[model samples]
Target: MKLNFLTLTPKATVIGLIMGLLIVFLGRGLGLFFFFMMLWFLVLSAIVSFIGKKYKLKRKLFEDTRGIKNVIANGLWPFLLVLAYYFLSSNQFLKYALIFAFIGSVAAITADKFGSEIGVLDGEPIMLLTLKRVKKGTSGAVTWLGISAGILAAFLQSLVMLPWIGYFGSAGISMLWLFVAAILGGLAGTLFDSILGYFEENGKGNKYTSNFFASVFGSIIALTIFLLLF
Candidate 1:
């Protein structure tokens, strides 16, 4: 199904502003960095959401606006990590890990959004697990277009967030290690989302939960890798 999103409803806007405030306030030293990165993610995701907009509208698969749930789903994990950073940042190791974890969540959401929105424009899709042909907007579906877009978004997200993350700092993590944690976490998280979509198609889950779990999963992946290397 084609769902359109870009505009945030008034309530969503209010909640989003609250979340932004939390990021800015809770981040303390990293406040500006989180604020700027969050804004950057918003603009990037919004642009991707606009792809095939005219076409999607005509096709009746677009919903035209996003609600508070959408905002919460997309922003919750990142926001929680920011909150965690406020409390746990005294530990140098956890601080850097939290930064990479934050990157993973943002990257995953951005990647998934890019994959779905851009993929819908490409052509028909096939289910990720079954490889059976499916509609272009079919949940759990895969398209080369979507895959490429997801990878690109993940890479770009990780690349841009590095400055905010401060290139591993005194935590002793290598830049390459951070990149591996982030980019791979994003890709894995997108795949996890599509797999969850399989359950969604069968009515076992919903989009909000899927998005939330996907972010958490991405964060875990990055954190796990970082810990492993540490």
Candidate 2:
């Protein structure tokens, strides 16, 4: 099956172009590191769009924001994380490369899915903050489905990280910090996205604040786990 993301605006194209350049310049995995990511984004975008059409999955999140806004808000943190690893870490970049990409991409997609699906399933009005009944689609309104979605979102991302950075066999513990980092980082990132939704529900001025904070929180949580556990 083939899907074209031509529906994506020129701005999104520009964002891809710029990210492509960054991957080429700042990304450390290898010459193909950025190229592969570029292709991944293209393929994923197509897949998501195709699935969206078949399933009527609202492309709202990716669409609501401007292309540049979407990229910066959604893509920048993960990009930075990869760039940091490339420059700072001595480990083979490919070893953890897919892990990084998985956490970032899956977290965003899952968060959206959880939020939308759970909201639709639960007929009760929801308080995005507490998940107690308030109003359907109300910002901060959470539901059982939403929480479940959050867990799924976090888990899938963790899975992407786990295969390469595996857990201990005898002890059933993580042998590497990246595994720990990716799990905590993904959960934090998912929650952060939800928190942003809450702000919209509450009429907070700055919506992007949550994304910025979430990325920072995810990074800190990942690094903290890496340091304390490993």
Candidate 3:
């Protein structure tokens, strides 16, 4: 039987394996970690694959697969926050904050990714600041359809963390808060990304730097909301 591993580059496969092991070692155990990892991987793959086919583009989706830098810039903070959650597992308060932060970070990045991939396809993008129509794929450009898709994507990504609610012993009352934090965080992150993109386009910074800052900003926003509400 052909294996799905064949489709991944050697480096990507290695990184996935390492991340799996790290998650298992971080107190999630093999079984639970594997389940979470599989679900996360599959969902992201489906999104990327759909966009790739729709755009008939091979390079954009696969760019991160070949290098460690993009993965670190876009994803490392969330993973570190996951590790922080485990480290603070003994402290219910801090653990809860970290958990929300982690989920928010992931949701933000997912929303941003969805916005970028799907948004570009919508014709006649408008600059977020000036409301002027810009070239398609122009930095800081947005559309109504794209923003709608991003909000929906954020909601879906938050739902993915539902299985952890029970595991973390979060009260049912807090469910709405989690979803709100995630959606808001996602929107905040995407806005940060667009702002940074505007600067990047004006020759202020590079894509990687903007993404890193956006992810960090999202995490902070999530943590802030959790602290305020609970």
Candidate 4:
């Protein structure tokens, strides 16, 4: 899919670039390996966004003007995790948890985005709670295609971080943990997003609010799992 950079609002574009640059710089300052990992993460996210736009997904957050807000909202958790990593790098006990948390956060957002964008293309979707057939793109509606896509997206997101796992000298064990954390976080985040979307669609809250909570919940779930295992 061709992504038209011109289609992005100037303000959003500027903000995204600034954020991207800052992340890269910070990541590099931490380590070259981390720099590449962060770059991979951003590149993958861009590709996903491109796919969503190419397919004409009805998600409002992907729109040019509103897309800026979506970027900031979704990027916040990962950004904070990176900052935490930087500050706590010297702390042996917390560094791995922070790294996994960051990975989990990205996985969650990636899965949710893929599921929502791809799921809506299915001919029919059923509400998660009711299991009744609902219109595609309807809040809380899910389809097999979307769920599969979500699972794949989460796995891919975690896979990209394998280098980080290798860097720590526990490739085999860390890989399994990262995969479990990412998949669980992704599924939980997507479900949380759907639940929040259901309320938002019913006039209980705005999309941004629901999305923010979903992101937070997704990250938390991943971090909790990491802590539990380690």
- C-alpha lDDT of all candidate models, in order: 0.81, 0.51, 0.67, 0.69
Query: Which scores better on TM-score, 2 or 4?
Result: 4
Quote model 3's TM-score. 0.81
Residue-pair clash count for candidate 1: 2
Give the runs in model 3 whose Cα sits over 4 Å from its true position.
1-8, 27-42, 52-66, 168-173
Query: Superposing all C-alpha atoms, what RMSD in Å does each candidate have to the true structure?
Result: 3.4, 5.9, 3.8, 3.8
What TM-score goes with each of the models? 0.90, 0.63, 0.81, 0.81
Give me the overall lDDT of model 3. Answer: 0.67
- lDDT (10s digit) by residue, model 1, range 1-230: 44433467777877888999999999978876777666666777778877788998887666557889999998998999999999999998888789878878887887887788888887888899888998867788878898889888887776665674453455556777777876777787788889888889998888888888988888889888878877
Q: Model 4 residue 25 lDDT?
A: 62
Cα lDDT tens digits for candidate 3, 162-229: 76667544353367787888888878887788888887779988777776777777778888998897
- Candidate 1, residue 11: CA error in Å? 1.7
Whole-structure CA lDDT of model 4: 0.69
- Clash pairs, candidate 2, are 125-134, 127-140, 127-141, 128-140, 128-141, 129-140, 139-201
Candidate 1 positional error at 42, Å: 1.2
- Over 4 Å off in model 2, which ranges? 1-7, 30-66, 90-119, 128-131, 159-180
lDDT of 4 by residue, 1-230 (tens): 53434344567667766766766666544444444444454555566555656445454535323367776776777777777777786776677777667767777777777787677666688888777887766777888888887888788777766656656555234577778888888878877877777776688876666666666777788889878977
